[model samples]
Target: MAVLTGVSHAAEPLALCFAPPHAVAPDVRSQWQQELRLILHHSGYELKLAACTPESIELRVLRSNPRQPQALGAARTSQSRIEPVVEIYLDPLAELIGTRLAGPLGRAMARVTAHELRHVVGQQAHHQGGDFPEGYSAGLLLAAKPAHFRIR
Candidate 1:
């Protein structure tokens, strides 16, 4: 079943729709998109969110998450289409910047986004560890290179 499931999505591109928060600087947003593109591309995924076309996955960067305050983001299968919808809270991720971890909000957002997308794409029943299920690491998020945020 797992093998079949993996095969089913192997050739499909990750066509997602998401926009950066309005408050972010244009350069920051552009850099974030490029960084995430590098990560996903290196990990064997194609990112099509820039076009913002209607797609199977949608991501939103919300002001805050009252239900799960500490969490950076979450994902759920959309009830209407059974597709994945991802929600990321900007405040919590923004707070991490300049802390002991020390990182930019955009990079942190990308890291969290990558993690949540994996659960939906993999249809993971359990987070076996490493990146998913497990919390994001400041070290990984703070890294200069983008290849470390692997989806699988």
Candidate 2:
């Protein structure tokens, strides 16, 4: 699963919408949605609580069988070219449920998603280098816990 890390400019209003598969548990889904909102709020991005359209950023959490748990979050420039569409995916059970390390995993997802959005906004490239001034560091997002969720 990919997490959203940070945005290029916080002042620009951005929308975050979840596109989950129907198989997800209600409780778990709610938790994930709440966590996403909290991450956006604390990170200083605007959360548009509407359904995803061509103009909005879409974040998804799905189950997959990979060697290691991972996330795939990316941002794409929209058709209008005014805002970027950020997409986040995560290993459903691994990152969203309450396991021993779930807190860190969720935080990581948020950070990675943010990173992808930055990429979409032309703040940073997929790869990092001295030339990329807006590189994302996962450590920053994990530094704080979500406002509504606790690790313990």
Per-residue lDDT of candidate 2, residues 42-148 (tens digit): 55656565787777766655454354344345454554552445545455334443342545555556555555655654544345543222333444445544532
When summed lDDT is taken over every stretch of 10 residues in candidate 1, the lowest stretch is: 2-11
The backbone clash count of each candidate, in order, is 0, 21
Which residue runs of candidate 2 sit more than 4 Å off their true CA positions? Answer: 1-11, 20-44, 64-72, 76-87, 92-102, 129-152
Error of 1 at 80 (Å): 12
- Segments in model 1 whose C-alpha atoms lie over 4 Å from true places: 1-12, 19-24, 50-54, 78-82, 99-103
Evaluate model 1: give its lDDT.
0.68
- lDDT (10s digit) by residue, model 1, range 49-119: 65465555777878678988878878865543324777877777776554412236666777787878777
lDDT scores in order: 0.68, 0.51
Instruction: For model 2, state the Cα shift of residue 72 in Å.
Output: 4.3
Most lDDT-accurate candidate: 1
